[model samples]
Target: MFTLPFSALALSLCASAASALNSKRHASLAQRIKSEQPALRSPVWHGLGRDTNFQITDNCTGSTFFDCFDYFTDADPTHGDVVFVNESDAWSLGLVSTTPTQSFLRVDNSTSLPSGQGRNSVRLGTKKTYDGALFVLDVEHMPFGCATWPAFWTVSQTQPWPLGGEIDIVEGVNLNPLNQMTLHTGPGCAPNTSASDYTGQQLGTTCPSSDGANAGCGFLDRSNTSYGAGLNAAGGGVFAMHWDGGGVSIWHWTHDEQPCDLADLSGSPDPSGWGTPAAAWVANGCSPYTYLTDHQAIIETTLCGDWANSNYAAAGCPGTCSDAVMDPSNFNDAYWQINYFSVFVES
Candidate 1:
């Protein structure tokens, strides 16, 4: 989710087949937050050679996963009904844990809290920041339920947001069956849609983080199993974000379809062999080097923020967004089981 200053954009711009479907499923909130903003694969180089190889720089995995990330204990910038807990609290509350095989991130699903008190959850960002790289995430399960919002993304930690840019690799609210890929950048930057090639369907053309209340350009994945319940049912998958001089692209592969090169963190990854990406932002209009840089990978699950609150009824979920948070049983499946996250850069 983007955490930039909000300015209202046309509700029509937010219109999409998915939203239309949501409209049919759930009723809209009284007032919507318009700022909700919401990739890929091949190694074939535009200016660089096809021989370009990406080597793993940071392989965050296993029991040490906790040490690789910093707990974000601050207030939810999206104003979700969540209290971002510190590492200590996160451990005690069972919000985060690491094992030899994977890491687990979960929100408090047992405690029925009073009104206005956000539930306990964990938000984490990698300690290392990168200007440009290939990010590969191996996921086994992700949070899902009414009023739940989960995302895996990258945003700059060194510069003010939109200045450094934001790239959402996997994001969705409620029981969204597909993933939404998006890019957020400052003014003067818009994706070259004509030149960009991808498999996912584009929702909006411009990438301005402000013009559309930070709606930023968004694209919805075509795979039914790319997100939420469908993703979990398919036994999870791999999400890759490739950001470099050419531009940024994202790809999603189900558990069985993941490329062999990506299976081994020790080997170099070749995107050229990965096929068409789900979403791509060509450098013709937006330069990745200029707009997207020095970013840390982020992972978290928030409840009933601007996007979820407004789209609550559309998902066919009962009650207001805040009310949904009070029911502990509503979040029985609210959790993330991650295999590993590997950052690769051109060698």
Candidate 2:
């Protein structure tokens, strides 16, 4: 568990105070998780129930592009969880795409349990709305190798880019050697003040890679741990982000970390400084945050190209190849061994 500086801690509580509605949303979110979904786990995954409450069935409902819109549209499907995972259809939605073949989102985890392509991302808009809840991301496997980029993030269902803040709960780049948590804000914001806080873990630092509006974006590689440089191997850990109504906080706890706080969901963000769009930023199909405080719903697993494919294979093809992606034999596919995806509420 990572500890937040006194300043961050204070700001977190403030954020929670503002978005009290989120508390109720959390309740509704938990109820949505019905027992089973025939379309969820597919046979190719060869999954075995790791826990009682959770079951990885071998049944994927394809991409949410065609079906996902149904959730909020006219032709709603008859299903259980109303899954919106990225799949073949997702590649066409401009929401999910893989290079070379556009089949980027993997179909396999540790137990040979396949993933459902792009994470289950929902659009947050004026018509479709919610209060507050935990966005549970099923710990699916990630492309394990040197030059592989994967991400599990959220977009504002309303605005285009920075108009809504971009909360990157999970993201790793080509051989980044670390998981970088970033926020892409547009204009109407300070320059140097774009990126603030500890991008890295204990005894670590956040090194901003780009300039311009995306300056706030950076990676958190915890090499100082006794585990050595990095190891996103067979068993991947939980990469979480606590979005306090005000400010936002992120952490990477692979069953490790010193001052880590998984219980704190209170994040405080500058409403006025949520970020506008800057011409210098690259946010194509990349949606930003819009009053991201009011939480609701539980989002699950998915593999996305825009955020995951560090090699940008969807664009054309990445030069670097990994055993996991290019040749599975050469590389070991890191399984985000998922036990139970649950959201706790304040009794």
Candidate 3:
């Protein structure tokens, strides 16, 4: 695994800390909106198509979490210090549950194990595969504690990895306040971030795994409320990714900043009116239709993975990721509170 120098990592951490302070200010604004506009609050959309232009394929809620996702109990492919548990084990350990409208997915928060690999957790993948579509996620809380690496991403099931492409919509490690969206693909695939109207800072232009650091093509959202603690403070938010024949675009709207159409969910989402995306990847050298296909949605929280381990000390955590992750007290806040997940296809 490749790593950045301590000096660079320190700079990144400082920047994230500044973002956290700003997010606190936005959280207060969101709270005022909630108090003043009670009528704007609406439950997550759980039914099918509301308009003729889009068809809903998956309407995942707290009640449907287990039914819609397949338990991925296998070993961590990213070499994280985690043991993924089966469906029965997860529920028996109180690591997964559902209330009326929200779903809770959590890590093992009761046991203090030895400082070897780490404690057990849950990883879930959607059973349905998609070619091209719009994915919208309404989340109330996300895993944000130290040593936690939470991600909401989509990957193709092709062998050798990155052949079909991987789109990371929401991903961050350690105590990162800002979200990092990335694209990993086989050779010859690169994104023209400069040509697109995205608000994030593009770390790299090429997405080929052959890049020495395997950094891929990454864009870092500067908003502190885009991930982790800042996100939860803002009452969570909506993440929408539209992938089609042309390219892929991702947009984020905090609870107080959601568009009227998204807030109401009365009809199909209109991305044309959503303005500039946080990150937009236009296929400059590769064909998006041919390179990105047969992908399934995945939501997981792993501990001490490659990225998290690389920046553990820089993030000012207590100790090494493996050691801290085994302590049950450290992960008290490590959990996913999802309101709903919906996929819309063009009609």
How does each model score on lDDT?
Answer: 0.81, 0.33, 0.78
Question: Over the stretch 185-283, how does candidate 1's per-residue lDDT look in tens digits?
Answer: 877887665534788999887687753287789899999989999999988888999998888889998766766566544456778767778888888
- Model 3 residue 236 CA deviation (Å) reads 0.7
Separately for all candidates shown, the number of backbone clashes (residues 3 or more apart, or on different chains) is 13, 48, 0
Alpha-carbon lDDT of model 1: 0.81
- Model 1 stretches with alpha carbons more than 4 Å out: 1-44, 48-50
The residue pairs that clash in candidate 3, if any, are none
TM-score of each: 0.86, 0.41, 0.83
In the range 1-347, model 2's lDDT, one tens digit per residue, is 21112224434654564476455456555453542233333121122222212112111122211222222221112121112433444344433332321112332322221232222222211222222223333232454433233445554545555444455655554344555555654443332222223334422122122243243544454542211125434233444343322234444444332122222222221112111211111112222133342322222222223343444453343453322333323223432223223232211
Report the C-alpha lDDT of model 3 over 130-238, residue by residue, as the tens digit: 8889998888889988889999999897545778888999999888989999888887886544633587888787787742457788889878889999999987888
Q: What is the lDDT ranking, best to worst?
A: 1, 3, 2
Winning candidate number (lDDT): 1
lDDT of 3 at 85: 94
